[model samples]
Target: MLNNWVDQLNNTRAAAAPFGEANPKMLTAFRGLNAAQGSNGALDAKTRELIAIAVAVTTRCDGCIASHASAARQAGATEAEVSDALGTAIALNAGAAYVYSLRAMEAFGQMGK
Candidate 1:
């Protein structure tokens, strides 16, 4: 029963996060693209998983992050790699959010009370 409930909830999440709703073709294409990327010989398994983690972090996607991080660990991403990916995400996020926030601050200054 517990497993069934978990499966249902996971299905719900997948349905909710469909690619371009009402477009089954696009969703199919998205799945194909992911499969190709995940299994391509050009990039090792570890590299692909790291990329997934980065995507998860960038989108602040808890579900994706949890899923990808678990896969990553299973596929041999060491603790170091996980930590490094997180650090890289944090650094990049700080810069990204900072650039926008800094501009907003400057704009606010221009608005003069």
Candidate 2:
């Protein structure tokens, strides 16, 4: 396994506790956002968790990966489904790099003029 995801989730929660305590308002707002998402009902939990996993991969957030992976599992996301989501993330990252490369080339061309 890449990581002890359960332990990582636990550790992340533990580490976040102090920050949450230090800034209760920020924590409340964050929690409110989560609650709003949960109540939205437009997407099911499994789909949301899958999207979260993909975003976590793209953002390189270990904590989010651990949390969302567990949530995905609990929401009945198959391994194949998670893999597909990851593939999408990989493709998006590659696409972003390709777009950025075009911008770099544009800047390089401008520098030459």
- lDDT (CA) for every model shown? 0.77, 0.94
Q: Give me the runs in candidate 2 sitting further than 4 Å from their true place.
A: none
Q: TM-score winner among the candidates?
A: 2
For candidate 1, what is the total of clashing residue pairs?
0
Candidate 2: worst 10 consecutive residues by lDDT?
A: 31-40
Candidate 1: tens digits of C-alpha lDDT, residues 1-113: 32343454476467755555788788779778877774649878887788788878888776677667777887899989987888888889899999999999999999996
RMSD of 2: 1.1
lDDT, residue 85, model 1: 83
Q: What's model 2's lDDT at 37?
A: 84
Per-residue CA lDDT of model 2 for 1-113, tens digit only, reads: 77898999999999888999899999999888977886858989999999999999999999999999999999999999999999999999999999999999999999999
In model 1, the worst 10-residue window by lDDT is 1-10
Top-lDDT structure, candidate number: 2
In candidate 1 the C-alpha lDDT for residue 11 amounts to 65
